[model samples]
Target: MRIAITGSTGLIGTALVRSLTADGHHVVRLVRRPPRTPDEVEWDPRRQWVDTDGLAGCEGVVHLAGAGVGDHRWTAAYKKTIRDSRVLGTAALAEALASLDTPPRVLVSGSAIGIYGDTGDRETDESTPPGHGFLADVCQEWEEAAGPAAEAGVRTVFARTGLVVARGGGAWAKLFPLFRLGLGGRLGSGSQYWSFIALHDHVAALRHLLDTGTLSGPVNLTAPRPVTNREVTAVMGRVLHRPTLCTAPAPALRLALGEMAGDVLASQRVLPRRLLDSGFSFAFPDVESAVRAALTDTR
Candidate 1:
């Protein structure tokens, strides 16, 4: 398969690109700057511009360009940046693909489990309606921005991703070192459910979305079972042979992360119902396996 990907340098995108190219697939990376390599394509979401010629012959496209939610303190301006980066970027990419003479067979646009905000102790799936809060709103808009591709009859799938557990990047990148040093603990009350998936599983799920013809709309990219923060702490301790005695109080976290802390502490028991029903299997289905995979860099 010849695939085109935005945010090809990001955590998930990087892994997906590696996995695809390793399997003899041609990968084109969409970048914001001028093309620096033969496979590089320049695009500007803010300007609503995409070099369509570069997208020619793409059998699939995985749109993953977005501002990191935890990259900066949630100031008003930075919040807008987060929203625009995903929503506007998706819209631009979708429009570009829709205008293509031969659109890709699949459009795996990025979404997040944050769409179901603060689902405390409640299991939610792709069928659930949008939740409240900033992330939820942004995710909703992000998925909606892909309307053009679906409207143009391209198979568009919204990958509502969960907390990716990996040593390479994302939240787990910071957590791995802390837990290894016995400095890691649960955030806030330590009871919030976290729906997590291993980096390998995430990459596989993306490929499944590209290859599976039946999948479309909001397909969650999460593990089967969701664990609480306390449970995750225990698993980390067990996996790393370290102590999990520390704790970050809610007030302290709120002060530290600003508005983003709420999301950090939010309880979302997301399940990959669609993925599972579609016969997708997880390499790491539980928190312990995921942590071990992250620590050992094993699939």
Candidate 2:
């Protein structure tokens, strides 16, 4: 299979590329820069320009391009960047795929569990209604932009990802150093459910989606068991052999993160019901075991 991917430099995309290539599939990158090699295709999502002809031969497309939600302060401009990056990129890619002579059979576009907003402690699956807020709106629009391919009879799967736990990137990476230094703590009341999945499982789930033709629409790419912030802190402390006594006050987080503080303080208890029902077994379903494997995995 020939796979084309956007945001190939991102943590998830990087892992997916390696996984697909190791499985003996040809991988092409939809890059923002000019194409310098046969495996790279140039496109500017902001300008709504893509080389449809170049991507015509692709068997599948994994759209992972987007501005990092936690990478910057949520200023008005940065918020727009976050929204535009996903919507425009998705729209452009879908349009290109729709115009292809041999359009890809599958489009595994990126999404987030944030689409469900603060679900409290409710276990949300693919069938649950979307919640409110900025992140939700962005996710809704992002998935909607892929309508073109879906309408054209292409199998479009939205990877509604959760907080990916890895040693070098994502939420876990940011927390590791703090926990290692004995400065780790829980956020807010430490009761908000934090839905997370190990990066290895995340990549594996994506691969499963690519291979499974019956899976489509929004698939919750999360773990079976979700933990609270306090539980997460305790596990990190245990893994690092540190005390979980430190705590970040809500006031300080609000002062520093401003409106984005809710993202850290809020809870989203999600479940991968669809994936599990479809017989996709997880490599790491528990927080402690997932953390240990991710921290120790060499590849």
Candidate 3:
């Protein structure tokens, strides 16, 4: 199968490309810069432009391009960057795909469980109505931006992902080092739930979305069992054979992260009901196994 992927250099995208190519599938990378290789295509999401010529003949498209939400302090400008990056990019890609004479069979658009806002201990699935807050508003707009693709009869699946467990990137990248030095512990009250999925499972779930013709709309890419921050800290310590003694106070985190701290401390107990109902299974469903998998899956 021929597939086109945006943000192919990102942690999730990179791993997905590798997994697809390992099975002899052709992969086209949509890059921001000039096309440097035969498999490269140029796109500028801010301008709502993409080289559709390079996306031709693609059977599947995975749109994951976006500014990192946690990469910078959430100043007014940075928050705009985060929102615009996802909304505008998704709009551009969806429009481009919709315009194709022969559109791809499916589009696995990236989304987040942040759509549920601070769910506290309440469990959420795909059927739950979107919640309130900044990330929720951004995520809702982000998914809605893909309307063109769905309207054009292209199957659009929003992969509402959770906190991916991996040593390579995301929040885990910073946490792994601290935990290795025996400085890892719970955040805020340590009671907040974290819906996490192993990197291996995350990539596999993306592929599942691409292949599953019967599935559509928002599908949470999270483990069935969500764990709390305290449980996660314990798992990390157990997996790395280190002591978990540090505790980051909510006030300290807020002072450091500004508006972004609310997201960090928010509790989201998300579940992969759609994925599981469609016959997708997680390789690491529990906190301990997920942490262990993150330790081994460097990519």
lDDT of each: 0.93, 0.92, 0.94
On the 0 to 100 scale, the lDDT of residue 289 in model 2 is 86
Q: Model 1's lDDT to the true fold? A: 0.93
Query: Over the stretch 1-299, how does candidate 2's per-residue lDDT look in tens digits?
Result: 99999999999999999999998999999999888999999999999999876786888999999999998989999999999999999999998899887789999999999999999988788889999999999999999999999988789999999999997677678898888889998898999999999998999999999989999999999999999999999899999899878888999999999889988988999999989998999989999989998889776
Ranking by lDDT: 3, 1, 2
TM-scores of all models? Answer: 0.98, 0.98, 0.98
Name the runs in model 3 displaced over 4 angstroms.
none
Clashing pairs in 3: none
Worst 10 residues of 3 by lDDT: 290-299
Overall local distance difference test of candidate 2 = 0.92
Cα miss at 228, model 1 (Å)? 0.1
After the best TM-score superposition of candidate 1, give how far the Cα of residue 138 lies from its true spot, in angstroms: 0.2
TM-score of model 2 vs. true structure: 0.98
lDDT of 3 by residue, 1-299 (tens): 99999989999999999999999999999998899899999999999999999999999999998999889999899989999999999999999999999999999999999999999999899999999999999999999999999999999999999998888889877899999999999999999999999899999999999999999999999999999999999988988899999999999999999988999999999989999999998889887898887777644
The Cα error of candidate 2 at residue 246, in Å, is 1.0
Of candidate 1, the 10-residue stretch with the lowest lDDT total is 290-299
Score residue 123 of candidate 3 by CA lDDT: 85
